[model samples]
Target: MNDEDHYCENCDMDLYGISPIYVDYMDLPYCSIDCLAERNTYKKYKTIEEANREAEKNRYRKEEK
Candidate 1:
């Protein structure tokens, strides 16, 4: 298997790969179904609806930070 095929050696997961591209917990990498599920909390939602909602929130939070 290739680097992409396996979990991110650095992160030890394989959730984000191929097609839409999986981005977990603030852009963390994953390797297997189990690994992906393990990061339910950190997983950055990939859906357009989710992104839009977070983007809107970020717009407001940016000023605070």
Candidate 2:
């Protein structure tokens, strides 16, 4: 496939538009930070669920104040 046709491995979304956040893992392209996190479980990187939970917590904290 051509460079323009590259898509994210996890979400299957077109990669060109969000290329800034693109990550390469084992020669595959991921389109977003979250997509990269979802695929890799290395140190200091949060999983999708952990990121979502943190976001939810921040949202609730905002609602309380």
Candidate 3:
């Protein structure tokens, strides 16, 4: 693997010897779901706080249903 492929694009976790690397829609790699979610949220909302707030609202709406 090249230098760029050796680490996750989101968390920079070493991908060497790690099986089943996670790839995003944009072809970005991640070590795990948490890292993927974090990067995706930030990419869409532009801030973690805003993404969290939206999640909370969605949770509340689900509870109400």
Q: Which candidate has the top score in lDDT?
A: 3
What is the Cα-based lDDT of residue 1 in candidate 2? 46
The TM-score leader among the candidates is: 3
Across residues 1-32, which tens digit of lDDT does each residue of candidate 2 receive?
45744888777887665653544445667777
Model 3 is weakest, by summed lDDT over 10 consecutive residues, at 19-28
Q: What is the descending lDDT order?
A: 3, 2, 1
Candidate 2 colliding pairs, count: 0
Model 2 regions more than 4 Å off: 1-5, 20-25, 41-65
Residue-level lDDT of model 1, residues 29-48, one tens digit each, is 55545555545534567665
Candidate 2 vs candidate 3, lDDT winner = 3
Better of 2 and 3 by TM-score: 3
Across 1-65, the per-residue lDDT of candidate 3 in tens digits comes to 56677778787888888853556445566788888778778889978889889989999999999
Q: What is the lDDT, from 0 to 100, of the residue 8 in candidate 3?
A: 84
What lDDT would candidate 1 get against the real structure? 0.54
